[model samples]
Every structure is written in structure tokens, then in C-alpha cells.
Target: MDMTTQHITLGAINMEAENPVELAAFWGTVTSAVPSVGGGTVYLPPAGPGGFAMFFRPMAGPRLERQAAHLDLTVPWGSRQAEVDRLLSLGATYKWDVLDEVPHVQWTTLADPEGNLFCVAEHPPAS
Candidate 1:
């Protein structure tokens, strides 16, 4: 087998949610992804090649443990704060903010409706 062909590529990140519809809607709105449902699963298609599709599975109960992994979203320069605010208004709960944690680094940590932690960071616009 060719070494390049054997390399793995991420397809999607499956998340457990008490309500797949709501969770899928949230992610769909954030990413502007097209949402689809079938076989009792909800999916949000990837925004681009670098992005991965999100799959939401219905869970029997509320999330009982902290998430060991989380999503990090980066916005264009000068848009991080506004994006955070918009997410908050869209049902994300604020966790904490770190400003100037390191030179030119600023971010805010937040949890989704299901208490899954994710971060929003600012990055320089693509040249």
C-alpha cells in the first residue's frame, strides 16, 4: 500500500446529546453547515475540507462526566470577542476569559448547552 494512501483522515466527531435535534441545530448554526438526519442520527456537514462533520447521537441521560476533548474555533482577527458574544447569546454558557494570556493570545472558554467545553480564539486573517 502507498504510505500516503495509508494515512488517516478524520471524518467526523461524534457527540452524545440529550437531544440530537437541538444539539445539531446549534452546531449547524455556528458552522453554517447543512443539517441532515437519517437512521436516528443527526449530522452537520463539514464547512470545508479542513473542517470535520459533526454527528450528534441521542443519549439516554444527561452528560455525567466532563468532556475529555473539546472543540476550538478560531475567528478572523478582531472578530473573536464578537463571535464569543454571539455564541453566548445562542445558548452557550460562559466559563471564563483569558486575555493576553500570552503575547497576542486571547480566548474565552465556554460550554455548550450540554456542558461540553469549547474555546473561541482569535487568529490573524489569512493573507
Candidate 2:
């Protein structure tokens, strides 16, 4: 395999929602990513360079089970709680909080309006 001859980049993270426009709006507000709509789908451009965009499409039927993957958003040290609060105000519901003393990390799990899970985390500064 010639690894150097082939280039691969993450294009987007796609998900299904009952209302794609509303779901995209929630994520767009949370990540500050502007959205573009077309072809029955809503796309949010990456928040910054090298970041992958997010795409939301209409669901054909009710989701029967929890999603196997979720997004974990990192915030500056000591800001996880505030970010979680802000997300809640923007229509996210609290799931739980994980505070690990072994590594001294904190993160709060949350679900979007449509029940998609995600997290906000704060990590210790590099020593």
C-alpha cells in the first residue's frame, strides 16, 4: 500500500433527524456553524480550518435504538459546566456528568432536542 500516494480527509458527520432543519439549527447554534440547505438536507460548514462539517437528513422512520456514536466537544479548562448550561438553554437536556479523579477530568453528557447524545468536556492543562 502506498500511503503517501493517497490522501483522505473527513468530509462530514451525517445523522438522521425527524426535523433536519431544526436539528441543524440546534447544532449550528451550539457550534456556531452556519448551515446551508439543499436537496432535503441541511449541512453545517466546519467551525474552523481542518474541521469536518456536519450533515442532517430527514429520518425515514423512528429511530429504534440509541446511536452507537456520539460527539464529544472539548472546551477550555474550567468551562465545561458553563458550556453545558448554555447548551441546555439552547434546547439540550442533561444526561449525566462524569468527574474522574484519577485523571482529574470533567465532562457532562447531554442530548439534543431530538435525543442525540453528545458531551462537553474539560481537561487539565498540560504540565
Question: Using Cα atoms with residue i matched to residue i, what is each candidate's TM-score against the true structure?
Answer: 0.84, 0.89
RMSD of each: 2.7, 1.8
Writing each residue's lDDT as its tens digit, candidate 1 over 6-125 gives 758888889988888888898888888887988768989898877779999889676766677889888877988899989998899999988866756678999988788999988654
Clashes of 1: 0
Residue-wise C-alpha lDDT for candidate 2, range 1-127, written one tens digit per residue: 6657767788999999899999999999998899899988999999898666899999988896868899988889988888998999999999999897458678899999999999898989989
Residue 123 of model 2, lDDT score: 89
Residue 27 displacement (Å), model 1: 0.6
